[model samples]
Target chain A: MSYKAKFRVWRGEGGEGKLEDFTVEVNEGEVVLDIIHRLQATQAPDLAVRWNCKAGKCGSCSMEINGKPKLGCMTRMSTFSEDETITVTPMRTFPVIKDLVTDVSFNYQKAREIPSFTPPANVQPGEYRMQQIDVERSQEFRKCIECFMCNNVCHVIRDHEENKPEFAGPRFLMRIAELDMHPYDVADRKDAAQEEHGLGYCNITKCCTEVCPEHIKITDNALIPMKERVVDRKYDPLVWLGNKIFKRSSSKS
Target chain B: MTQTTADSPARRQRAQIKERTLRTDQWWRYPLVTFIIFTAFLVYSTWAIFDTSYFASPYIAPYASPCLATSCPEGARLFGLAPFGDWYTLPPGLLILALPAGFRFTCYYYRKAYYRGFWLSPPACAVNEPHGKYTGESRFPLILQNIHRYFFYAAIVIGLILAWDAVLALVEKPVGLGTLILVVNAVFINLYTLSCHSCRHITAGRLNHFSKHPVRYRAWGFVSKLNAKHQQLALISMFTVVGADLYVRLVAKGIVNFPFA
Candidate 1:
């Protein structure tokens, strides 16, 4: 059941590029990644594309398919109409290296900005106990594969590149939120998420959640809860009065 | 894996390099204008708060109304201040302001508005921000913004207070244009307060199932409808708050007396 499928892949380097069309053979159960591989094999040998595992786990095949941010390996070919021209473009937010690959250094930089998990003094590594409820909460955020699809679809920094410095995008913000939620982690992440990570920039459009190949609730579970935590500390009058009565009880001064 | 030769007519060469990687257009203009407008509003509000002449019928000035201290002029104290006694002789506006300010400051929409407008942390899309490193609101002062839900609750109470003020505006048995203005001001304030992101969340955040909590679901529905125009409400409330304060001030000062009583 091999069929010749059409693909319009943006081919270029250093930012300037255009969609170049090609027809490649699609096998019975092939995905976009298979057709991209075929495009590499048959028509354009010099065509540059980044992929690993071809099983969607690697998250290496991230690109905009028909203007939608998605993992090429995960996006089934059957989703599109047979006669439809499949448009595969490089992720628009970052600088294009060549063909479908774009420089994803922005995400890496944001990752570095976040302070890593800090266990409490009493709890040694592998000795700490977490309630199942607490464990499940962190587990939900732990499912992220760093696909950058969430990053790509995030409108906060996606179209707004200057916002890159301020906004940490959805993924890293969620990472901070995850660390804050961890039971044993004693560090005050609420402030860090607010001041350093640009947590305020996310408007909860849920585009990140929509594009997540991992199906993680990036908005509802992570971002919104993180927002709520910020509210609890800052605006809660009881907390305000408590701060006045018992000053500096916590590590955060 | 490619058997095809490296040089092929079918293989299109990548496009020429772009001169500048990012947008070259004027992206900073919008945020800059927003910055200017908000700054002006802050200045005007600060000036209005200090002006002791803001009272007309002791009910005219919304900002100074329910003035709790003994120092407040005749008929100004809606209630006496027993708890915060002798704290200061500052206008009740100082005591009353934090509610609406907190609501606006921590507002989801205002967070975005000010984050871009004042911070210039990007200012707008594709435009480089002034600062090299952005730490974000997870810190001490900024983390306080998280209490927006609490502020939402406070704003609702404050909105009720302002609405009461509107009712009291006509209690002297005078039918004047001031009465209409005060009523409209209260309406806008309520619109803004009810349309808050926290209000929307509070209405539905606790519910596991909408079908289980029909009332909250309906409340959320109304809040959502208002939330859609949240931006308009934010601006409208701002104008009304300032307008109501200024109107009372002028009338009390005998500067622009619109006599109907």
Candidate 2:
């Protein structure tokens, strides 16, 4: 089956843009990315879009569809009514380079801020051994394809640009949580997660978890557990007393 | 992708979009609904606390359980003990309401709900909040949410008391529909309490390795499973408690006659 689909794609450069409407042809089993490609081929020769793998794995085709953060490659034309007008816009959190493509360097900046896995001084790479259960704790987060949709949808930075300097958003915060939960990575991430990465800004709205394409429980399994773990160092009086009485040095210190 | 615009001044700033969000979907509906529900719960709980008619023999209202005052009906008194004597004139619910109330208020899930629903702190994901400044929970007052573990302990004690009340309802002569309701409410209370994020953490959160602590690992797994549904349990338990309290209140007022009462 073939039909014409309406599209309202945002087009602009240098931070100025408007939604430009296009009537594009659609085919059976075609995703939004396909219709977008068709628009580029037939109608608008100068349309700008960033895409790598159309298989929904590259995490390169992320755009807002009908006001929801989604992958253009994953959203099928079948999900929308034939007459419905689909709107494609660049992610609102970052600077726009051109149509349907926003500068995602903010995510890379936050990613760089987090300290990578630091193992014990004695344990070699091959010497590291952990239970399957421990591996599963962080395995859920490994599914993240760097979609950056979580960062885009997170309100801390999405609505407030000033917060960009403080909050790490959900994606990198989950990265810190993953390393913190690792059985062998001994660096103490609890303090740095709050003080440096702005873990405290997350009000646990779970919007990141909602928009996650990988179905990972980012809030439940990673963020909340990390928040509670932070309490062991910062808030728990009993833990403070125990540390004082025993004279045990923290992992990082 | 990184080399597309190097050292461009415009690349340093976010896109100058004028609209709060281009979202065409009804994003406002969620927070508005959440506001209405929380407000209704607050209003009903306020009324439930002040009303003294909270007992109907074998079934004590959850809000007024443990009937600490001497003014309480003899049949409704917990094991016929009045700890406060006649010195305390206020409602018994006033004495203990703070505990469960504190638990819910400090709950991680409820924090999200009320923050979005009531405070309008970026009500939905992309919507702009009216507030100009956002310090979040890092400061005083909101930072007190760290005391959630203490509230979790209090909630466990309250859950135990509610369980005892449910048992009393079961054993004290004929069981009515109120008995079933109270029992279900007690179950829900415990479920919500055990499913707490704090509970999940205390079980095994700080452990460096789960292999060494087999028992804590098992407990952590159970709590983690329950914690996934914490939001649903939070809402269900709230409504069930209200329903249980209202049922007992109506029976105490002689408004509704249950079979075998």
Number of the predicted model whose DockQ against the real structure is largest: 2
Q: What DockQ number belongs to candidate 1?
A: 0.09
Per-residue lDDT of candidate 1, residues A22-117 (tens digit): 988887777888888888888988778888877778888998776677788888998877777888877767766778877787789889988888
Model 1 bad stretches (over 4 Å): A1-95, A99-150, A153-168, A171-226, A229-253, B1-26, B79-87
Error of 2 at A241 (Å): 2.5
TM-score of chain B of 2: 0.95
| TM-score on alpha carbons, each prediction | 0.60, 0.96
Give the per-prediction TM-score of chain B.
0.85, 0.95
Give the per-residue lDDT of model 2 (tens digit) for A85-194: 99888888888888888889889989999989999999998999889987788988999999899999988888778899999989999999999888888888999998
Specify the poorest-scoring 10-residue window by lDDT in model 2 chain B. B1-10
lDDT of each: 0.72, 0.87
The TM-score obtained by model 1 is 0.60
lDDT of 2 at B16: 68
